[model samples]
Target: MSKISKLFKGVSGSSSSSKSKHRARGGPSPHEAIHKLRDTEDMLTKKQDYLEKRIEQEVAIAKKHGTRNKRAALQALKRKKRLEQQLTQIDGTLSTIEFQRESLENSHTNSEVVRNMGYASQAMKKVHESMDLNKIDDLMDDINEQKDVAREINDAISRPQGDDFDEDELLAELEELEQEQMDDSMKSMGGLPSVPSGRLPSASTSYRATTKRREDEDDMRMLASWAT
Candidate 1:
């Protein structure tokens, strides 16, 4: 028994020494630590590359433009995200319905959950309907209204009967009459006397010189008054 006990002690001592050695080695050298850091950096680099590729794909999917297209794309992405969120909510509600269906076969509490689930489902349907509805309906209505207004305007302008209204000939005659009227206006305006070729002094310089001259006169008058 004593021999066996000594053997066990020796074995434990050996095991302890081996563990200490392993621990010393496991505490990595500075060089190994730097290498491991580099490896981690390489992994990060690969991950960044993958992410950049995904971003490039997204950019490629969109057309390039300024604010107008960018805003439109943002709106489209927002709509898609909203739809996805609704779908996820619908899925959760469906899951709840299944759970309630299985467990509470005939309870009033389960009935409420069923109704809640149904409402969520109905809400999801409504969102889909909203998405499906014509976004440009108002614009189309406005355009049609404008077209009707234009037609009304055209109808309101009562030109003489077809025989008297030769559009091409009338346009030519109207242009000639306008030219003649413009020529007469020009001749009338030309009858006025031509402006004198001289330019008056600038207002600022004129006022300054006049003020200075008046100040000099006043000074001279004061000197004269003193002399007198």
Candidate 2:
């Protein structure tokens, strides 16, 4: 028995020392540690439930031996009290375990957040490795130069190829043409009757006057023929 006890103690000590060394070496990742803590919390909670049930059972037993069996009643009460104490201990232990588990979970979450942020930072660093302000400036200058060349090409394409005419020369030629047309029209009007400078007599008077003049001219023509 002593040998067995000693062996068990040695084993326990070795296990504890190994666990301590594992902790020193950063034993479990935060996620793994949180999961284990949660498992412990669940176990403690089950124990708490069991202890509560046993306490209730002891209370019932105490009530059953109300007066007839005072010794049994006392024994039952005593057992109930011990069970209640155990339940209280379990409650405290559960609180502690729950707090520890929650703390581990929060720490794990924070660690992941920091790790992801680091990864993002590294990714950004890698992305920027091939780029610099000078290169960016040069690229922009090239783009602007291309745009200017494109604009010039578009302008050249849209412009008239070879039919350029001077606007001033064209307008002067048009004016000369108009002047020639006016001169030709004036020459054409020369053979037509001229307009009267003054107002003429009425139609009836003018007709009578023209007829009398014609008769006189005919009488003169007759006299000249007789003389001949």
TM-score of each: 0.20, 0.56
Cα miss at 222, model 1 (Å)?
A: 99
Clashing pairs in 1: none
- Local distance difference test values of all predictions, in order: 0.69, 0.88
- Candidate 1: global Cα-lDDT? 0.69
- Give a tens-digit lDDT track for model 2, residues 33-57: 7777778778878887887888788
- Model 2: runs farther than 4 Å from truth? 2-14, 17-26, 142-228
**Ten consecutive residues with minimal summed lDDT in candidate 1?**
57-66
List model 1 lDDT by residue over 1-228, tens digit each.
Answer: 699999999999997986797588885444444454455545555655554555554454444433558876675555545545655554565565455444544454566788999999999998887673476677788899999999988887865555667699999999999999987998888755677799978999999999999999999999999998
Q: How does model 2 fare in lDDT?
A: 0.88
